[model samples]
Target: AQTVTQSQPEMSVQEAETVTLSCTYDTSENNYYLFWYKQPPSRQMILVIRQEAYKQQNATENRFSVNFQKAAKSFSLKISDSQLGDTAMYFCSEAGYRNSGNTPLVFGKGTRLSVIA
Candidate 1:
């Protein structure tokens, strides 16, 4: 069994500031995957970043990045130069068993991020 946990229930960041959300997971499979998804007001889940357990370097997007510590099973998301549009619910997820290519994500409750202008 695998479970994802987001310690922060909500967070706020002023425009152009930086914010980081905490996340952790428990899993027995070595080939599992971790992800951060953003849910906007439109109710769509957008992939923010992803880290493969096999990779030592964390994954990064344009303004979004992750601090994935495989040893401690921690995967956190960092939003640099946050904007108002970044206000949304962020969810951490984990999936996969072994050698499988794709699987459905098991997500945490979420962290509602509010970006004030």
Candidate 2:
């Protein structure tokens, strides 16, 4: 069994500043994908970034990026120039083995971030 942990219950970042959210997971599998999903007040889950276990380079998308530490089993999200729209509940997730589409993604409790001016 695999588990994701997000120690921060909540965080606040000023607009245009940078913020990093921490995440750690326990997994023995060699091949898998890690991700950060953001859920706003609308209750929709949006994929923020993803990192492959086999890839050494950290994943990045515009202002969003991830620090993937394979040996430490840590995957953290860094958001640059935070904006009001970045305010949301961020969840760390891992893809479990099972390509049948029946397997579920293991997620953390989530970190609620508030971007203020």
Q: In order, what lDDT does every prediction score? A: 0.91, 0.93
Clashing pairs in 1: none
Report the number of backbone clashes for model 2: 0
Least accurate 10 contiguous residues by lDDT in model 2? 95-104
Instruction: For candidate 1, write residues 58-98 as lDDT tens digits.
Output: 88899999999988989989999999899999999999864
Which candidate has the highest lDDT of all? Answer: 2
Q: How far is each candidate from the true structure, as Cα RMSD in Å?
A: 1.3, 1.4
Each candidate's number of clashing pairs is: 0, 0
